[model samples]
Target chain A: MHELTTTRNNYQIDPVLTVWGWEIPVYLFLGGMVAGMMIISGYFLFKGRQKEPTCSCFYVPWVSLILLSLGMFSLFLDLSHKVYVWRLYTTFKIASPMSWGAWILILVYPVIIANIFIRLPKFVTDKFPGLEKYSKMLTDRPRLIQNIGVANMILGALLGMYTGVLLSSLGARPLWNTSILWLLFLVSGLSGAAAFVHMVAKNIYERELLAKADNGFLTFEIFVIGLMFIGLATSTEVHQEAAQMLLSGSFAPVFWVFVVGIGIIIPLIIQLFAVNHKIQHTPVAPIMVIAGGLILRFVIVNAGQVSHYLNAHF
Target chain B: MARFAMVIDTKKCVGCMDCVVACKTENNVPEGYNRDWITQEAFGNFPNIQLEIRSERCNHCENSPCVSSCPTGASHYHDIGGVVLVNHDECIGCKACVASCPYDARFIHPDGYADKCTFCIHRVEKGDKPACVSVCPTNCMYFGDLEDPNSDVSKLLKSRKWHTLHPEAGTNPHVFYLT
Candidate 1:
């Protein structure tokens, strides 16, 4: 049989082509989750102990640490020469968002680690006196820790929003450049954070402990999802192209199945059942909501990057 | 002072990519890399078609987004003739400027520096035309000082109907293409 042949040029005909692959979306998801967790934890920390400090406060630091490390690792993997990536910090430039993000992560990581260490149980702390002393030092200076937490919150918020802005700044890539992308990213981040917390709580805590933790986060996530949809629908042509991909283009199946089906609608339906049954205090609904939120982040990040500017014209 | 510029006559261009090869050779552009290239838009399927071929390169814009986005001041417009050049020593290779360029003019070189068409600044400084202008078989590429009335580029600007890529970007690129 004669072979069907297609010749691909070494040269890219499209000027807007990018080498930014899976790393970009991974970075976005990680940044969103980190920002979300930091915000939720900061809110609870500043507002005093919630119904369950074990799940909301103590678990958040560990989860944030894991996500932050994973995201940073993925970022390194995205680089062409991953070994030389450390040089980015030495010759920093303020105009580059990546540079800004790199510095922010450096500052944020240690504080998160410190926060996590301090909140550990006395048995663990007593076994390691040096660690226990360090924990005590941070706890004794509550104001310093508070300031650190506030900075983390503000920086985390920017980190979350900046991922969208980073994409938006490429005005030529009509798929990315938009004023509303930042808000969409922020809402998604919060949703991802809520989902992550729900998952972690489900894995670690008993049924009684889960019931004590607030289920209100599900309602908040639904509201945010609605806002994200509205923002996507009303944006400009480039953004419309990206949004359309979610609705009907190559990204539609994933967007519909994962983001809408699993993340938004499923959680909403589950929460409705819980509320109607007067099971507002239950953990099952929030757990489902959180699963949906994680899946939403996965779908959006992958979908956003899959469609390129040149692809739109062709 | 003379403002350096290029004038391309699209009708004369055969889409041979001679200029693309000439540019890479002159610039020491890395293997599997390019400093300039051509794009073709063809309509109405094979055997009943019309084609438009355009040479593409960094425009050396008056308001270059690449320069603005470079966090380390590595990519900057030259003071002498407004040619954009990257300082290899200072570039962090974050590829921010690469992403910022509207025409996809810039690339992150293997040496971890942002690289693009410099309008052959070294040759221009030595009173020579860009290699692409000198090497083009059909005489499609013209380079000269835009400020001098006698210069070919300036005269062409006055005489021909021309356009630059992405005029809406307000970069006022030095390169002009005759349609």
Candidate 2:
């Protein structure tokens, strides 16, 4: 009863901008968080201040491995040829940032895994049974793990800054070609790590200790967020367009609702108002901090990817 | 010693995508992928319309960003001829070159190495024209050695005004388009 209508294809589609996608930003966030966790754990270990061995020594490495694995997997998934991904290491083009990142991941992952193995309770217990009781006794002593912590810190810092430098080196993408992007990434990474640790600590530690760490992480997050914003705002037009996309363009709602609202504002306010007077045992602050950190990565990744190179306006 | 280059006349191009199809077929370009393409910019939405067409591929720049961004040294510009090629064995499928390229020309091949228009170096080495040049129905595309003053390309360069895309990138691209 109805005449079939074949619609003419009037609109032409430009080749989609396919360079950096959700993976790059997410990788940056994950790498930064790992670096942050390593630094925090390393600092605490070196100080011999073992407030909670399970949280710092055990959980940090485990989480780092998990995040690292996930980040690397995301990178591979984004590759057009997933099967030959290993060839990237051998290709060794000095001009390519992706090649550098691949090599860095190869080196960093092994070191982090080894560090985790050394701290695992079972490994320590089985390898040196004689030191078991002494090791348990030494858990609370911050001085015992200080060296490991320092190593972690150094490694973590490199991991954090690499994400920023990687993007900045692409001068063609005016949006990412800036030195400040590195600093912003570094600071945000540390904040994300602190938030992660605070969350983990909340679940493992007693109320009082959890509250203190949450407060510390929340304050640190606010400071870093401010720095990131300032860095983004001061950049050149190309970078400004990227920032504007987050602030008001297609990426605005997610940027504001998730990155700024849930990731920064909500967690900050909860820590400042709702939990400030509460006893240290509450789980809310830590949970909020973790939620905010993840959301921050999501919004940033999406925002950075929405712009195109072909547009005259860009 | 062999410096490869291409000159395209914008006026002669009819937006028929002959070069695109020819390059794809010659190079065995995978389905849903393109190594060379024609871009058309049409003005005046309705009734009164004018269109400008551009044929684009890897410019084989002197300062190729794809080469520098590849961590594995898989992508490199040949020092002798300045033709960019990928060393497939060394590439790790990282896509760094793809991101760094301003023209969006390089792509990850199915084998995991970066791939782009090599200016048909294989055919050139055999003293034959590139597939696109030989097949172009309108004779819109020109290829030759830029170094030899007697070459047709060199003669064209001397006589015609031409421009390269994203000259601000400082890549010193070999491909020139005459308006």
TM per prediction: 0.81, 0.82
For candidate 1, write residues A1-314 as lDDT tens digits. Answer: 11111111223223324456566677777778788788766655554433354547667877888888998888776664445565667767666666677788887787677657547767777787667777667667767666656765777788778877776665655545556667667766766676556545543443232222323444554565566556656765455677777678876787677666766666656655554555553445555555554555555545544444444444
Tens digits of per-residue lDDT, candidate 2, A1-314, equal 11112111111112434555677666777887787777776666665545554546556778888998898887777665566666665455455556566677777776565456444567666877875565454445545356557777777777777877887787666556656666656666766666666655643442334345545655655665565556656864555676666667776787678666766666666655534564343446555555666666565544443343443332
TM-score of predicted model 2?
A: 0.82
Model 1 C-alpha RMSD to native: 5.1
**Model 2: share of native contacts present?**
0.45
TM-score of predicted chain B, candidate 1: 0.92
TM-score of chain B of each: 0.92, 0.91
Candidate 2 lDDT tens digits, B58-145? 8998888787777766677776578898877666666667767777787766655677788888888788888888888888889988
DockQ scores for all predicted structures:
0.29, 0.42
Looking at model 2, give its docking quality level: acceptable
Q: Second chain of candidate 2: TM-score?
A: 0.91
Cα deviation in Å at residue B110, candidate 2?
A: 4.5
